[model samples]
Target chain A: MANHAISACAPDASIESYIRHYAQCIDISLKQALASSNAHPKLLEAMEYSLMAGGKRLRPILMIAAAESLGAELERIMPVACAVEMIHSYSLVHDDLPAMDDDDYRRGKLTNHKVYGEAMAILAGDGLLTHAFYMATLAAGSDAVSLQRLMLVIREMAALAGIAGMVAGQAADMEGEQGITSLEQLESIHLRKTGDLIVFALRAGGRLSGASEAQLKALESYGYGIGLAFQIQDDILDITGDPAKTGKAANSDERAGKVTYPYFLGMDESRRKMHELTESAKQAVQQAGLPDPQRLLQLADYLMQRDR
Target chain B: MANHAISACAPDASIESYIRHYAQCIDISLKQALASSNAHPKLLEAMEYSLMAGGKRLRPILMIAAAESLGAELERIMPVACAVEMIHSYSLVHDDLPAMDDDDYRRGKLTNHKVYGEAMAILAGDGLLTHAFYMATLAAGSDAVSLQRLMLVIREMAALAGIAGMVAGQAADMEGEQGITSLEQLESIHLRKTGDLIVFALRAGGRLSGASEAQLKALESYGYGIGLAFQIQDDILDITGDPAKTGKAANSDERAGKVTYPYFLGMDESRRKMHELTESAKQAVQQAGLPDPQRLLQLADYLMQRDR
Candidate 1:
């Protein structure tokens, strides 16, 4: 997997350096997005704590990179990038609530609810979710993107993150936790829960960057293939990856009796499926005829092989 | 108060009839907004439970009436009306969670968490909030309202309902719950928590209807005045109104030991202040030079005299 990632990026620097650079860019934008609003101090504090807590920031990077692949300036789409990350962070905070997953820790730090009280945590999540739309409204225009296109991006982002999308996936996941026994049911949960937002991020980037309908269709296919692979890799890592590397306890899913890709398919079959999906994702990007698909291809490989 | 309300409506029908008619319009719109989504049945069930559970539909009615007073067709801005109500309902669901106000009932029905369980209730709120932006994007255009104007309404709605507005107010109210004593502090909380959204509803209606700068200013002042009066009356009702009429327990605010207008000011002083504010609100609407300010004037009077 590492060899494939390196070979995919041989024409440029390694995927590691690219991810690091984009991650730093995302961090700065996220901070600026949350900066010193006149909002209540404690609420801002809670929002900042979860937002600033480190993660791969993979979603925003994919958004920016996707736009960049289509020849758009990074600054033009920074707000959309930050908005997606804000939505992601808010979901995490709510997911960790006592009434939800009841998680005590996340990304090696105390969960939002563990540090802030449950009420504050809930409000923090609410604030972040509302502010994501507020941030998206700030997505300014350039030669490549019109305000109408930006509005379309905002509309699509909201839909993908909304009830029929991410929230739907979450609701289904909560319901399925009582014992989802079929692979189809598991896929249904993963598709809505994880796939829709990933597709939105890529499609939003494409739409904002003036991709043709055909190109956007290719990106949609690419996003779906990789989204499923990503979740399967997550499931595999839960069983085999080191806790220190994964930022979560190993075998926890099994202990909780949660149905996952590996649990349904076996570790070897899950790995095989992930590899096939990654190949398809890369092929989709290649077929899109984008000016620069190398970075996305490398991203697909990197996601499949990441230790953490 | 009753005499003032009757006199204010002498130019038209009673405000009570106007409210009932507009309330039905809002109910139909709200129902349409929530219909036929492919979201999880349980999640949608929870959202619909809180959303369709009856309230006065006051905010949406105010928005529609304010727009209609300026001669904008109600159908043109129905999306904004429904969106505002969605935001309102989402807040109530989250606020009634055990981690927040912990209420068992709302609008005479079981609170969302009480029926759906906490995790589902939280997801339900998240779903409705996101779905509101989705619904707003669906606001169809007409010859009278431009897309830009509709976008502005959506942007302002999100801002007012987001951090630094309603969410900020909620955070402050939560913080202030630990025995806030000053009248100024209490006023600050009320302005953000309850007042901003109310103001947004009125301003949204005016903006969508192409109100002049002078008229917009009048609506702004009118919103602030009535927003305060609305809360003051709510506080007074908590102390004196019948539970059956209010659909909530009497004196619950006092029992909760939360700060309120009447808690800081004497009942007579609070009543006097509410009356004064209501008069100012009516005057502002009257001064706006709208074609039909009678409904708005009567609304101001009716809000002050409402028993629930």
Candidate 2:
């Protein structure tokens, strides 16, 4: 029934198809813009290496999907989609910097600063982040309403990516590794560090589409639920996920001594929470009266089930 | 004659008055928006400390003056002006970070990392630099010309502030400490690093003012000349500047084995070159037919002659 409702509204487009299309929108611009600062061939090559490496492209797709449900034009959402992905790419690059996470191999590829050398990696991240706005400016070209929407979207991205959001979470994550973490502390750390950006991604898309006030409010609630659901699923997968499909070591998170939902709650309890969060997310979307909830339902299911 | 030109324009606004007027034009809206994102007040405070610190406000004032010259409204220039200042502030903060110059002070005050700790300082700089564009969007509103101008101004600023410009220059400077730089190499680094930003500042103002294409060309020339002149003055001051006036150690450049024009050409030749650059800059503005070149002329002369 859920799939029937979703398909009726966004008929003929598979969730996978939409995600692939969104990724294409992001990669075309991301690769072109960060490629050159002053015709430096090597820096572009390195940025391409990290950026092209297959991560989920989850944030960008979320932004686009949310925007679509609100009736935003494709052009309007592309920039915000690209911007969120760029921010994600930048975080990954910096996390691999010498002063930070430092282990280097990410998504089963050599880390950015490691492959490109430390200095180029740092500049690559800076260039990518700066260029994201250059891309987002495209959205500003549409209308004041659109531009205002873009501004809010980017503000949310920057805040999540900056001190209060990603950076703070990263700091807390770093601190947690040196000691044991209480469940509450761990949740607090993850909320800002990871959850916030994902939430922004969902809500920004809705904003771009000019979703009705009621719709926007509901999407926000949906975003909060799914953002946590996504993280919780990752925690579960870290413990029991298939390495072949996930392309990562199943127990890597545990080995790292990192705090996770699974670490705080037993695996069984974590599973229960994930299911509840996914249901909660679906309810929020339903409450919003989305014309098509099929893909969104699929997304929620994927979030609750996926190992990676 | 100089006094007559100065008097012919509006009465002498003290530096404080000039700086404050520029400040009034800078948007606080973006800052207000980000205020609530704080997980800790210290990070925000550290960011504000450097961002809000008293300086000549040279870059922003240039942008505003350019806007005014073109008959562009104050509202139109505010975002770009703030963006430029944010870039400047980030550079200062990072330049004082542990991996870079490692100074504990800047502008005669405790440096950002000093007050906030290294990690927070780094994050603060990154945050301000990235958030600059979000602020620019708010200022841009719906004017395509203004928006286009914003992009142009931002691209130029990025080129100046990034690896091809200031940051890259810093890299070469630190790396070349053990080596003797030929005059050409020293000039290249300075032109790209320090000169790039100053030139960008001038161009930003010119673009915002809706200057004619020919006028922009002329302003470019103005930027190049003043930028070089400004650096030469610094080289001269490093040798004989009052430590009190500079709020820095006398002859610190020499002690640090920095590459400087004066270091290469000696005091007499450097002064002669600075005079030539200053003359060219003045001629460029004059040829542009600005009704009031007095402030700009005074500005050029002040930069070339400042003891600090």
Candidate 3:
């Protein structure tokens, strides 16, 4: 029944195929990036373990798709795409630490800290974060993007992932452990935590491809909508997802007293809200007059209908 | 007696004056950099607490001196200088975490983990590291350094600080905690752990100042010599310096069963090796034919004679 519902929502399966295509390309690039790193063997192993752990590759795909929408070549943006994934992977590594979320498993495998020990995991996170920037800077050598544009992309990536954006969300999530006061607070936390990086991915891709202000704004809205929808889906999955499929124990959020959309708005309302966001994200893409909004629109629908 | 001996070694005293001058400039720039950051208040506070904490600020000072040797303006390299110090500061914060060094005090003040708790300290460290690159990228906006030069510096900074250098050393040190078998291993650890960033400081400064290949190589040799000497001094200080002065417990390394220069070569030989390295470092600078090598030469001698 769930499969049927998803198929009903995503009438075009081409987006799913494209995601697989992009993921394969990104996997190859990510491997190439780490294989050349002469880090300590143990550290390298830990970093590889987490980075190669199965993921949706959503951020990087969004970046590539955004750039493609602007008629930019994939080769030019591949480094940046890989970089965003690295940032995401590093965040997951740190977020799984004993000092942080203390998760034992992720994606049905032992977390980085569990496998490599707390200290190595921390360094792995640090290493990945630093290497992400190193990878982004490599994009500067490409003739496709101007140095000034690359600088803006680099600066925005740092700001979005640093204290002001992702770090701020992490800090708030920690502080809010006492108790989340309102829906506004929860939304704000997710907006900065999840939305900022998503926005960075899309905007960076657009800017690299010489996006006009209006086009950049459209991508931002699309990114913002999808980011919120993604988080909402995560919240929904915590309540309804299978441990085998989601690679995490269901209801863990509720057990941990974590605030989520379903917790505040109830399951039905949360589902409605998520679909609404996804609908708006698709509309934003369609209205942007991009040369290729089809891929982005299909991606939004595909994400909205995902089981995990 | 120690003060008198230092004065005898550094007869000019002008380098000490220069250190003080450069340190003041760095402090102000660092403060301004953080003041405008819109990071979460607690995260910002944690970053500010450690960044503003008193220390030698040697890395940034070295950067400034290297740039000054090539007649570069202070305003142009100040961002990179501050960026290096930020990197140094972040490493200290993370190194003091309970999972790593378990250090409670640094520079006579409570460690970040000790004051802000472990999780915040971790985030604070991440914030600083990311912001360091952000700070470095700001230099791209400066007219003094070309975009290509700035890219090289940023890449080097990340490499030296990331997996291949500082992180590699840290991993090796942790893995060797059971027992460091040889002096060579100890030297290698310190060379990457402490040396790479120092080398980065000098090279980046020189590069930003449009240095010739020979001048850059000279700075590399000078940096390596001082870097080794610096670690040897740290080992000696761990054994002999006052806790009040050094802001660390004497003989802590010995207590931790960590290997050191003195452990391998004995006190007399360690002292001799340190002085020999410093002498070579001074000679490297003097022979570099830089427009102004006096500051670099004097600083090397002054560092060699320091008690803490």
Task: Please report the candidate that would top DockQ against the real structure.
Answer: 3
DockQ of each: 0.48, 0.30, 0.55
The residue pairs that clash in candidate 3, if any, are none
Instruction: Please tell me which model should have the higher DockQ, number 1 or number 3.
Output: 3
For candidate 3, lDDT tens digit of each residue in A101-159?
Answer: 88998888999989988889999999999999889988774342487788879889989
Report lDDT per candidate. 0.83, 0.69, 0.86
- CAPRI verdict on model 3? medium
Which digits, one per residue and each the tens of the lDDT, describe model 1 over residues A1-308?
01111111124667898898778778877777777456688999999999999978888888877887787766667778888888999999999998888889998999998898998999999999988887777764432236667667777887889888899888888888787989999998888888888888999888888898899999888898999999998998898899999988989888978888887789899999999999999999899889887778889999999888
Task: Name the runs in model 1 displaced over 4 angstroms.
Answer: A1-11, A140-145, B1-13, B140-145
lDDT of 3 at A49: 99
Q: Just chain B of model 3: what TM-score?
A: 0.93
Winner by lDDT: 3
- Sorting all predicted structures by DockQ, with the top scorer first, yields 3, 1, 2
Task: List the lowest-lDDT window of 10 residues for candidate 3 chain B.
Answer: B1-10
Tell me the spans in candidate 2 whose CA falls farther than 4 Å from its real position.
A1-14, A17-21, A36-39, A70-76, A140-152, A171-184, A243-250, B1-10, B14-39, B52-55, B71-76, B102-105, B108-110, B141-185
What is the per-residue lDDT of model 2 for residues A84-201, given as tens digits with 9 covering 90 to 100?
A: 7877887788777666676768878889867766656665676566656556655665444554566566666666677677767766665566675587787777676777778778
Per-residue lDDT tens digits for candidate 2, residues B213-248, read 777777778778888888888777877888898877
TM-scores of the models, in the given order?
0.94, 0.84, 0.94
Off by over 4 Å in 3: A1-13, A142-145, B1-13, B142-145
Interface C-alpha root-mean-square deviation, candidates in order: 3.2, 3.6, 2.3
